[model samples]
Target: MDHIIEAIASALNISVKQIKNTLGLLEEGNTVPFIARYRKEVTGGLDEEQIRVIQENYAYQVNLEKRKEDVLRLIEQQGKLTDEIKADVMKAEKLSQVEDIYRPYQQKRKTRATDAIAKGLKPLAEWILTLPRTADIEAEAKKYINDKVETMEDALQGAKDIIAEMASDDAQVRSRIRNSMEKYGHLVTKAKKKHTDEKKVYKMYYEYSERVSSLANHRIMAIDRGEKEKVLNVSIDFDEEYIINWTINKFTKKRTSPVNYLIDEAVKDGLKRLAFPSVEREIRNELSEKAHEASIEVFSMNLERLLLQPPMKNKMVLGFDPAFRTGCKLAVIDHTGKMIDVSVIYPHQPNAKVKESQRIMLDLLKKYPIDIIAIGNGTASRESEAFVAKLIKDYNLNVSYTIVSEAGASVYSASKLAREEFPDLHVEQRSAISIARRIQDPLSELIKIDPQSIGVGQYQHDLPQARLKERLDFVVSKAVNRVGVNVNMASAELLKNISGLNASCAKNIVAYREEHGEIHNRKELKKVPKIGAKAFEQAAGFLRIEDGDEMLDRTSIHPESYDLAKKILKELDIKEEEMGSASAADKVKEASVKKLCETLEADSYTVKDILDSIAAPLRDYRDQYAQPMLRSDVLELSDLHIGQQLEGVVRNVVDFGAFVDIGLHEDGLVHISKMSKQRVSHPSELVAVGDIVKVWVYNIDEEKQKVQLSFLQP
Candidate 1:
């Protein structure tokens, strides 16, 4: 346990005490969000990400230790465990290292070496290893010739096979070779001779070569996808002769020995046939694992930002899901995300009833207090935007429009939850409602869909699905917890993402709310089925009751800290009802945190948090982010020109750059090189999803409808 804690501490550059305490909290069934938010003092104020890293590292360390024990016990049972072998196994930091050390002792399938050993060639193989200067190799091989080994050549070959397998099984040699490949190998990809890549999606990788150490994570995933799709043939390129010669030098001890040739041949054969393939596989697997991790991280960050986009509060939004033949679907949703009206308009081709569509839209605009239009960036979106722009200009309607990524609207519309929510509505109508709700409350709406379907990162489909899901779930949970949920208003989907609530618990909370009416305070949550002591402890702080019986419940103050909070409020001579008032804020601001900690006998972290919560009981972390871009006009691909300046919202950030929506059907691409004047490792360093950025159109490809943008004006 000490060793695991020390290793995690060293790896994360955190104190051993902090790692130990954090691991203890995690082992006690506490969630990362719970530990980060409620137990800051115990964790030394470690953030959610830090605590998650410690938890992951502790799991890895525990698994590694268990694997080492299993390997040690297995070797001991075989009566082959030695002090040095045990030491090597015990000291291995990675599971792969321990597995490599135990490879020779593992029960393998039928192989040339095992076959040779069964034919009395083990003695000959061992004798050959001595490198005797004056030995008759044929005569020695003749002794091993029997029914199984018919000829002297057969015996010699068997001996060589045994020696080859032995050399290949050397842990140090395998490790050295793996390290060398990782450091010096090049990943080479070529277009397959026969493939159906008419779009040339992998054109850049058709004849690509990159150093394994320097390849970007995005490119790795792209190449992997291309290879899987049979568009590219990928392999590692390395100096094979150098590696073979190195292995030969390691095994060869005498220059004048008669059996040196045999040893050389055997070492080469071992590397080429056994060790090289296995090491290549390991290197590729390691690279893929790292690439998946990086891609998942990018996906998670983008998803978090997209989920945390500030709500377009108090605005009645019209969700416009545009299509050509099927007509554009429209649904008017009130500020509370309740669908109040639904309509359809054929604004584009085949059924180009422009006048009728205009009449329908204008009537809806007049009937409802629709302040803005949330147009889905799907088929016929550009035409729909143009129509809306014309209506606002021609009739002079007091309305603006913005493009909402309808990436997952269809999926959500077809979901079981969506079906239950709007069983009478068609799929498109439900999609329209989802689109409007996404603008009003992105966190709540997005949690209903799979994170991978949100479409904010590169190559999400190619990523490891399970790992990607885990990471995305964590991101959603963190975002949901950061922005506290109103239990009375939250859906089961949103509640499920709260700190300690699972799907079943969240459903029960909603059921309880439905049956017994709105929960008036934090204490009422315990009455809900499945929300026991631990669940309440983990979840209560993040579940807000804005107009609850208890004012502290409206804030993020945990139930356990209410007494202290009340005492502090009394000390400041502020009433509990004045928690979010100007007078309360002023008083809390005037109170010294150091004096309060001393007086109340509490930790400074909790005191500061309580004071801040008092200043604004219903503080939203999402309010700090820029709202979604609302535009009164639309830009066309044909209207774009070089050097034109525009304001755009960053829709997605990737390894290469950020895609900014500049009021066009196709989002503009701001390449990494054009992100800034200074050197940037990744585009995320300069911009993130949801950021409203000013960019210049450096180049425009009208043929492909691609706009190349730059941060600096040309």
Candidate 2:
């Protein structure tokens, strides 16, 4: 256990005490976001990312230890467990190393080496290695050429097979070969014979070769997907002769002896027949796992940014779900995201009822005091944008519209959760409401759907489903917890992500709220089923009661700290009613953290957190992030000219670059090279999913409806 803690500390570059404290907290059912936000002193101020890394690495180390125990016990049961082999297994840092040390002792099916041993030629195989330089190999072979072994050739071949297996099973030899392959290997891919490049999607990879070390994570995932689809054949190749010579040099002791040539032949045979294939597979798997982790990290970060998009609070929104055949679905949601009205307008092709659609839209605008229009960026969005633009101009409506990504709207609209939430509404109507609600509160609405369906990732479908889901779930948890949920208005889906809350507990909370009235205080939460003391301890800080009697209940201060918070507030002469007023801010700033800690009998960290919360009770962390671009006008692809500068919101960020929505039907691509004049390793370094960036048109392909943009402006 101590060694595992030490290993985690080394991997994360943190103190051993910090890791131990964090592990203790984690073992006690504390979540990563909980540990990060609430246990600052215990973890030495480690943030959520650092805590998650420690947690993940500790799990891996624990699994490695379990595997080591299993290997040791298996080898002991086989009666082949020497002290040296046991020490090697015990010292193994990774599962692969432990497996390598246990390879020879593992029980196996019949093979050439096993057949030779069964034929009574084991002594001859061992004797060949002990032979001197002048020893006659043929004389020894003849001695074993009795009953089962018909001839000298058969005896010698059997001995060679045994030698080959021995060389291939050596742990050190396999490790060296695997390391060399990783260092010097080139991964190459080619078009398969049966596949054609009609779409040219895999054309660049048809005859592509790149050093294994230099291949980017995105390219690796792309190649893996193409290979899985059978559009390309992929293989890793390296200097085989070098590997063979290295193997020989490591195992062969006597270079001038006649047996030396036999050992050399066995080494070459082993590499070609067994070791190379096995080692190549190991290296590729290792590289793929690394790529998978990196891709998941990028996806997690992007998802976090998208989930934390600042809400357009206190605004009545009109959600426009664009369509082609069916008319555009429209939903009017009030400031609190309650559906006030719903309608359908056909402003696009096949119907093209522009005047009629305009009349309906203008009437809805007059009926409801709509503050913003959120058009779904799908289907006939451009036509809808044009119609809205003309209506706003002719009617001189005092409102603006922003294009909202509707990637997962259809999926969410048809989901079981959506059905439960809006049982009476159609799928398109629910989608229209979702489009509007996402703009008002992205984290709440987006959490209702699967994170993978949110569509901010690269090759999300190709990723391991369990691992990807786990990672995305963590992202949602962090985002949801960061912005505390209002217990009154939050749906069960949003409440489920709160720390220490699950589907059952969240459902119970909603049920309790429905049976009674809105929960008005932290004490009332205990009455909800499954929310015992421990669960309340973990979740109370993240669940807010907006109009509650206790002001701290509305803020992020945990319930346990209520006494300390009250003491600090009393010491500062600040009233609970005026806790967030400017006068309270002045009192908090004027009070010394050291003096408050002394007065409250608490630590400085706790005092500072209390003071900060008092200054800005119920502060939304999403306010720190960039808000979506609310556009007063729209642009078209045809209206773009070369070098024309425009404002765009980064819709998605990938390894190669970013896709920006410049108020057009199709998003423009800002390639990585055009992201900056200075060298940047990734597009994320320059922009994130919600960043509003400035770019100029560099190239346009009208036939393909692709727009190439450059963030580097003149």
Please name the candidate that would achieve the greatest TM-score relative to the true structure.
1
How badly does each model clash, as a count of residue pairs? 0, 0
Angstrom error of the Cα, residue 59, model 2: value is: 1.3
lDDT of 2 at 390: 80
Model 1 off-target regions past 4 Å?
none
Whole-model Cα lDDT of every candidate shown, in order: 0.91, 0.88
Q: Residues 1-714, candidate 1: write the lDDT tens digits.
A: 898888888888989999889888988999999999989999999999999888888888999999999999999999999999999998898999999999999998999999998888999989988878799988888888778999999999999999999889999889878887789889999999999899989999999999999998888888889988999998888888887887777777535689989999999999999998899888888888898888788889999999999988899999999999999999999989999999999988898999999999999999998988999988888888999999999998898898888889999999999999999999999999988888999988989999888898787877889989888989999999999899999999999989888999999998998899999999999999999999999999999998889989889999999999998999999998888899999999899999999998999999999999989998899999999988888788888788999999998898888999998878899999998888999888888899999999989887887899999978
Across 291-361, the per-residue lDDT of candidate 2 in tens digits comes to: 88888888998999999999999999999999988999999999999998999988888988888888899
What TM-score against the true fold does each predicted structure earn? 0.98, 0.95
lDDT for 301 in candidate 2 is: 83
Q: Judged by lDDT, which candidate is best? A: 1
